[model samples]
Target: MITVDTVCALIAKKLGSKATDLTLGADTAFDSVGLSSLQIADIVYTIEDDAEVELDPSQAANVKTVGDLVELVETTRAAGAAA
Candidate 1:
C-alpha cells in the first residue's frame, strides 16, 4: 500500500515549512528538491520508525528519488509481512 504520495507526504510532514516550495512527485529527485544527505537520512529513519521495520542500510543508500524510496518501503514491508 506504500505509494509515492505516501512517501511524499511523509517527507512533507518531516520537513514541515521547509518543503512548502518543493513540488514532490514520484520522479522527483531528492537532490533536485534540495534535500541534504542528513535530511534524507532523517526521512529514511522516519520511514523505518513508521513502518516498524529496519531497512537495509545499503539499500537505503541507493535511493535517489521519491519512487525509489516508495519501492524500498514497499519491498521492506512485503518482506516483513512474509516473515
Candidate 2:
C-alpha cells in the first residue's frame, strides 16, 4: 500500500544526501530538497513500476511536498482501480 512513509522514502532515495534533513513536511518545497526534473521523472517511473499504473503528469504537476505526492499516488491509484 502507498503510505506517506513510502512516499517519503521514495523522495529521499531520489534526493540522496540532500535529503538528510528531510522531515516530510507537508509544505516542504520539492525544489528546496534538490528534486530536479530528472529526480521527479525517476520518482514517477519508480511509482509507476511499483504500483503498475500509469500516472498522469498533469495530476502531479501541483504536487509540492512529500505529503502532496503521497496524496497524489493514493488518489491516482483509487481512480485507476475504479476504472
Candidate 3:
C-alpha cells in the first residue's frame, strides 16, 4: 500500500521545496504546486532514472493524486527490485 507521506516527500524533493509545504492528505491537483506537463514528464523521467524502473504509460496516467503517485513509486520500486 502507498501513503501520501511518501508521495509528498518525493514531490517536495523534485520541486526543491520543503516537505512541510506539501501535505499528504487534502491536496487534489499536482499543477497547483507548480508542476506542469513538462515538469511531470521531467519528474517521470527522473523517477525512472533515479529509481531505475520502467513505468507503464497507461499506469502513469492514473497518477493524479498523491496516493496514486505513492503507489506508482512503490510499484516501480518493486518492479525494479524484482529485476
**Best candidate according to TM-score:** 1
By summed lDDT, the worst window of 10 consecutive residues in model 3 runs over: 17-26
Per-residue error for 13 in candidate 1, Å, reads 4.4
Q: What is candidate 2's lDDT per residue for 39-81, written digit by digit as tens?
A: 8778767877787777788877777776777778778889988
TM-score between candidate 3 and the true structure: 0.58
Model 3, position 52, has a per-residue lDDT of 62
lDDT of 3 by residue, 1-83 (tens): 43565456566776784446655453545776767787777766666666566788889876776656666878888877888
Model 3: residues >4 Å from true position, as ranges? 1-28, 79-83
TM of each candidate vs. truth: 0.82, 0.78, 0.58
RMSD of each: 1.9, 1.9, 4.0
What lDDT score is found at residue 66 in candidate 2?
65
* Candidate 1 residue runs with Cα over 4 Å from true position: 13-18
Model 2's C-alpha root-mean-square deviation from the true structure amounts to 1.9
Against the true structure, candidate 3 has what lDDT? 0.66
